[model samples]
Target: MIYQDTFGFAQQQDEQDELKSFRDEFLFPQHNGHKVIYLCGNSLGLQPKSAGQYIKIQLDNWENFAVEGWFMGDDPWLSYHKALLPTLSGLLGANDREITVMNSLTVNLHLLMVSFYKPTNKRFKILMEAGAFPSDQYAVESQVRFHGFNPKEAIIEVTPRAGEVTLRTADIIAQIEDNADEIALVLFSGINYYTGQLFDMESIVKAGHKAGAMVGLDLAHAAGNVPLQLHNWGADFASWCSYKYMNSGPGGISGAFVHERHFANDKLNRFAGWWGYRRDKQFLMQPGFDPELGAQGWNVSTSPVVLMAMHKASLDIFEKAGGIVPLRKKGDLLTGYLEYLINNINQKQGEEVYRIITPKDQKDRGSQLSVVCKRDARAIFDYLAQNGIIGDWREPDVIRLSPVPLYNSFTDIYHAAEGLFKALGATNA
Candidate 1:
C-alpha cells in the first residue's frame, strides 16, 4: 500500500478505520489539556475507561459479602481468574485448560524454568537470542548458577551477524542445531524488546524439538500484539505480562501457557501452593500436593481479584473488538504510515538522519518502530514530549514509537511524525 505524506491522508485513513471508535474506550494521558499521542503501548498500555468500574464491582462484593466473598459472591474471588480464560485462550491460541493467570513476568519465567530447564551435565546449557530483556538475562544467569554452572559457559547467545539489525530465521535454527549437543533449553522472546523483531516461534520450536531441547517464550512484548498458536507451535511453555498490549494496569498479573502434553507428565517439577491444589479438595487442607489438572498447577499464590478485574475490563474490550484480527489490520497500516513518513524525511534531508532498526517486513515486526536518530537523539525525544507525542527512548539513541491498535489513531501517528519533523528544525536552531 502506497502512503501519502500529508495530514489529510492520515485523517482520511483514520476516518475509514472500522475500529476508530475503539479509541474512545481507553483513558489517555493529558498534555496541555489535550490527549497526548500515546505511542508507548509497547511499554505500558493505556488504561481502559471501565477499569475503575470493574474494580468497584469487586470492592462492592467485598463490602457486601465480607469473608464469604471468596465463595459466595456472584463472581467468587477464589475462582476469579477462571472468568478470564476464554478470552485469553483466544488471544493466546491455547485451549482453556492450557493457560492460567498468576505472578509477574519474570517471576513466572523463573517458575517455568524450574520445570522446563532441568539439565544434565552434558546438555546443561541454555540457548537464547543475544540482548534479551535484562530481567530474562538475570533469570537465566542465576538459574544456571543455582544449578552449579557458570553463566558464561551455560548460556549460548545467538546474535545478529555484525551489520544486521535482526536475526535471520536460518541463523537462529542453525545456532539451535549447532549447539544441539550441549543445549538443554532454548528460550526466546516472542518479540525482542529492543529491536521489535518478532521471532518465528513456530520454526524455532520445531527446530529445538528436533534437536532434543525444550523451547519457551517470554511473550512480554508479543502476547496480545501478535497472534500466537502456542499449542499448535508445540512450544513447551510460555509467559507474558498483561500490562503492555493486554492493557491490564501497570505491573498487572502475568499469564503462562503449558502444552497439554505436559499436564500428565509426572517427570516435571513444580514449586506449588494451595491455590494450585485440585479445587474440590483444596479446602480439605490436605498434605501431599495434589495439583490441579492443567496450567493452574503452576499457581503459587491466591488470586489478586482487583488486578484480575482490571484485566477483565480490558479483555472485554478486546472481545468486543472481535479479538486481534481486526485490530492487527489497522495496526499494520498505522505503523506503515509512520515508517513511510520517517523514510521520506531522510530522503528530503539527503541523509539517513533517522534509521529504523526494526525489521522492515510487516511479518517480522508488530506496531513498534525503533528509530535511531542519527543526530540530536535526546533533544528530539524531548521535543516530542513537549509536543504531546510520547514515544519511549532507549539508552544512547533510538526512539521507540509503537502505534497501538486499541487507542492510537492514524492521526496520532501523523502528528507524531509532524512533531518529529519540527523537532529537527528546533534542534538545529
Candidate 2:
C-alpha cells in the first residue's frame, strides 16, 4: 500500500475502485466552471442527484391527495418513515424496532435524556468528554439545572493527558469507574467532533453498567461515516444528525436508537404526543398515552415527509453501494492516502508545518484528518478556499479535510495535497 504523490497513481487507484461510479451520483458545487474538490463531508455532504425526484414524488402526492395524503398516496404519509428504518437500522447495526427517524440532533438527545437520564439524590452527575459539541454541553447543563442541580457539581468531564491531542480509552473507562457512585448517565460522542477519535463504545457501556449508570451516545459525526453496532454494544440510547456523512441535506431529520431492553420499562419518562401513540389505536382518539412498542414511541409530532424523502434518497444510494462495510473499506483507503500525503508534505518542508491531531489508526478514526497548521493558519485556510479546495475550519488553527468515499475519488486526494502544498507557498508559511 505504498502511496505516490502523483496524479497518475491516483488515477490508477480510481480505475480499480469498484465504487467509483458513485461519484457520478452526486451534484457538486462548481468553482470556475469545474467541480470543486469537496472535502467537508464532516460538516455537510454533497446532494444526491436523486434527491429532487424523491422530493417531487412527495410534492406531487401532496398536490393530488391534499389532506388525504396521510393515507392515500403511494407512500402514505402515515407510514412514510417506516420504509426508512431498514436501511437506517442497517447503518446503525440495530434492529428496525430499535431505531426511529424524528427531530433534530439535540432535540432527540434531550428527549432521550428524559427517558434515560433519571437522576437521584445519590447519583445525580453525568460523565462526558470535555470539548464535546457545544449543543451537547448546553443540553446536559440545562437538564442538570432543570433538576435543581448545579451544572458545575453535576457534570464530570474526562480530559486528555497533558500535551496529548486525543484521549486514551483507558482514561475514559477509568473516569467512568472513578465517578461510578455519583454518575447517573454516561454520555459521549461516538466520535469526538474535534479530534475525530472514535470511542470504545462497548467498553464504555460495560463500565457504565457496572457502575449502575445508563449509557448514551451522540453519533452526529460517526453515524454513516463509520460502522457502528449500537445493539451489540448495548448502548441504552443514542441520537445522530443525518446531514454530515449521511448526506440527507442541511439540518436534516435526525434519528434515535433505544435498546429493546427499555421497550417494556414503563418506569421511563417521556414527553408524549399523538404521534407516539399506538398506531392501531391512534385513530380512536383515546384518553391515556398508549405508546407504540418500540423506538417509534418517542415520536412527538407528525412525520416530516419531505425531510424523510430527502433522507430516503441518500439511503437508496447506500443500499445500492452495499451498505457501510464497502463504504468504510473505500473510506479507509481515501483517508489513509490523505494522511500519507500530509505526512509527505511535512517531510518535504523539513519541519512540522501541519500537525494532524486525529488518531493515526484507522480503527480509531473515520474519514477526517484534523490538521493543525503551525504557521499562517488563517491565511492558509483562505488560500485553499480560493483554490477551490473546500475543507472545514475550526477556530485557532485546526482544518478538517474529510475525503468521503461515496463521492470522493483518489484523484481528489491528490489534488487536495497539491492545494495544501501551493497554499503553504501562497501564504508564505
Candidate 3:
C-alpha cells in the first residue's frame, strides 16, 4: 500500500474508486466559478444534488393533499419517518425498533440524561472525556446543576497525561475503576470532535456496566463517519446529528438509540410529550401519557416532513452506495494518503511546520486529521481558504480537514496537501 505524491497516483486511485461517482451526487461550493475541494464533512457535509427534488416532492404533497397529506399521500407523513429507520438501524448497528428520529443531539442528550443519568446518595458523579464538544459540556454541566449538585464535584473529566494530545484507553479504564463507587453515569463521545480520535466504545461500556453505572455516547461526529455497534456494544443510549457526515441539510434532523433492554423499564423517567404517546391510542385523546414501545417513546413533538425529506435524500444515497462499510474503506485510503503527503512536507522542510495531533493509527481515527501549525497558524488557514481549499480551522492553532468518502475524491486530498505545501512558502515570505 505504498502511496505516491504525484497527482497521477491520486487520479489512478480515483479511477479505481467504486464510490467515485458519489462525488457527483453532491453540490460543491464554488470559488471563481470553479468548485472548491470540500474536505469539511466533519463540520457540515456538502448538500446532495437530489435534495431539492426531494423537498419538491414533499412540497407538492403539501400542495395537493393539504391536511390530507397525513393520511392520503403516496408516502404518508404519518409513516414517512419509518422509511428512515432501516438505513439508520444499519448505520448505528441497532435494530429498527431501537432507533428513532427525534430532536437535535443536545436536546436528545438532555432527554436521555433524564432517564440514564439518575443520581443517588451513594453514586452521583458522571465521568466523561475531557474537552468534549461544548454543547455536551454545557449539557452535562446544566444537568448536574439542575440535579442540585455542584458540577465541579459531580462531573469527572478524564484528561490525557502530560504532553499527550490524545487519550490512552488504559487511562480511561483506570479512571472509571477508580471512581467506580461514586460514578452514576459514564458518558463519552464516540469520536472526539477536535482530535478525531475514535474511542473504544465496547471496552468503555463493559467497564461502566461492571462498575454499576449507565454508559451513554454522543455520536455526533461518529455516526456516519465510522462504523458503530451501539446495540452490540451494550450502550444504554446514544444520540447524533445528521447534518455533518449524513449530509442532511444544515441543522437537520437528529436521531437517538435506546437499547431494547430499556424498553420495559417503567421506572425510567422522561419529559413526556404527546408525540411519544402510543401510536395505537394517540388519536384517542387519552388523559394519561403512555409512551411507545422503544426509542420512539423519546420523541417530543410533531415530525417535520421537510427535514425528513432532506435526510432521506442523503440516506438514499448511502443505501445506493451500500452503506458505511464501503464508504469507510475509501475514507481510510483518502485520509492515509493525506497524512503521508503532510509528513513528506515536514521532512522536506526539515522542521515541524504542520504537526498532526490526531492519532496515527487508522484504527484510532476516521477521515479527519487535526494538524497544529507550528508557525503562522491562522495565516496558513486563511491562505488555504483564499485559494478555495475548505478545511476547518479551530481556535488558536489547529486546522481540521476531513476527506469524506462519499463526496471527497483522492484528488481533493492531493490538492489540499498541495495547498499546504504552497501555504508554507507563502507564509515564509
Candidate 4:
C-alpha cells in the first residue's frame, strides 16, 4: 500500500471510507477554531448527535405521563431495555436471550461472579492477568474473601515473562492447563485497558472449559471495538461498559452476557431483585421470586430509561454502519497507518525514542495504540494536548491514542502524527 506524509493522502482515504459519514453524527471537541484530533475514543467516545433526540422523547414521556409512563406510553419504560437487545446482541455475538443491559461495569462483574465462581475444596482458585485493572483486582479479591478464602491462596495471577510487555497466547493457554485442577474460574479482560492488547477469546474460553473451569471476560475495552462470538465460543459470562467504544455517555449503563446453556441451570445462584422477576407476574408483587429466564434474570433493578435512550441512539449508528466486521476492517488500516507514521518518526530520530506497547499483529489489538516514550513522556503528552491533539496519559508514561472507526478520520490520524513529531522536537528537555 502506498503511504503519504501529506494530509491529502488522509483526505483521500476519508473519501474512500464506507463509513465516512459517521464523523458528522458525533460532537467533536473544538480547539482554536479547529476540530481537535480526537484519538481518545478508547477512554471516552464523542457524543452522538442523535443522543439528544432520543433522550428528549423519554423526557416528553415523563412530562406528559408522569407515573403512568411505566405502564402506558409509547415504548413503555418497563421494557425499554428490550429494544436495545437486537443491536447489542449483534455487537456481542450473543443470542437475544443471552444478553441484557443493566447496572455498571464493576457491579455486573461481582454479580456474574456470584453465579459462576462456585468454589469447591479441590477447585477453589480464581486465575487472572497479573496487571489487571485495579477495580477487577479488588472485585476478585473481595469475591474470594466473601467465600471464606484468602486471596493470596485462592487467586492465581499470570504475568508476562521477563523482557516482554505483552502476554503470549501459548503461555496463557499453558498456565490454564497447568492450574486446571485447582482453578474454579478463569477471568480476564478481552482487551487490556492499558496495553490495548486483544486476547484470543475463543481459544481462552475453550482452554478454560477443557480444565473444567468457567471462563468470563471483562470487555470494557473490547466491546464494540472488536468482533465477538460469545455464544459460539460458549463463554460462561462477559460484562462491559458502554462509555468507551459503545459511545454512550460517561457512567452509562453496562451490558452482560451468559451462554444459553446456563439459562436452564437453576442451580446457579444470583443476588436477586424485582426486575429479575417474571414480567407477567411483576405487577402482581407476589412474595416468591420467579426469575426471568436468560440474561434478564441477572438484572437487579428497574431499567434506567434515560441511560437506555442514549445507548439506543448510539446503537442505531452501529446498525446504520452495518456491524463490527466492516468497522474492524477500517480500524486495522487506520491504526496500522498511525503505527507506520510513529515508526517512521522513531527511525528519523537517532535511537528508538517512542515505543508502541500494543501488539503488532492486527488480530491481537484494537484501535488503541499505547505509546511509551523513552524520554520526557509526560512533557510530550502535555505538548500534544496543548496543540489540540486529545489522547489520554496513563500514570508513569503511556499515551493512549485511539482512532475510532465511527467518528475518527484518516486525516485525524495524520494530524495527530504531525503534532507528535512537532512536540518531540519542541519539548525535548
Which candidate leads the pack in lDDT? 2
On lDDT, who's better, 1 or 3? 3
Write candidate 4's Cα lDDT for 313-375 as tens digits.
Answer: 999999999989899999989999999999988988967788999999999999999999888
What is the model-wide C-alpha lDDT for candidate 4? 0.93
Off by over 4 Å in 3: none
- RMSD for each of the candidates: 0.7, 0.7, 0.6, 1.0
Per-residue alpha-carbon lDDT of candidate 1 for residues 338-389, written as tens digits (9 for 90 to 100):
9999998888889999999999999999989999999999999999999899
Mind giving the per-residue lDDT tens digits that candidate 2 earns over 126-187?
99999999999999999999999999999999999999988898999999888889999999
Residue by residue across 1-429, what tens digits does model 3's lDDT show? 799999999999999998889899999999999999888999999999999999999999999999999988789998899999999998999999899898799999999999999999889999999999999999999999999999999999999999998999999999999999999999999999999999999999999999999999999999999999999999999999999999999999999999999999999999999989999999999998899999999888999999999999999999999998998899999999999999999999998889999999999999999999989999999999999999899998999999999999888899999999999999989
Q: TM-score for all predictions?
A: 0.99, 0.99, 0.99, 0.98
lDDT of 4 at 19: 96
Error of 1 at 233 (Å): 0.2
- lDDT score of residue 405 within candidate 4: 96
Q: lDDT of each prediction vs. the true structure?
A: 0.94, 0.95, 0.94, 0.93
Q: In model 4, which residue pairs have backbone atoms overlapping below 3 Å? A: none
Candidate 3 vs candidate 4, TM-score winner: 3
Selected candidate, larger lDDT, 1 vs 2:
2
Candidate 4 residues lying further than 4 Å off, grouped into runs, are none
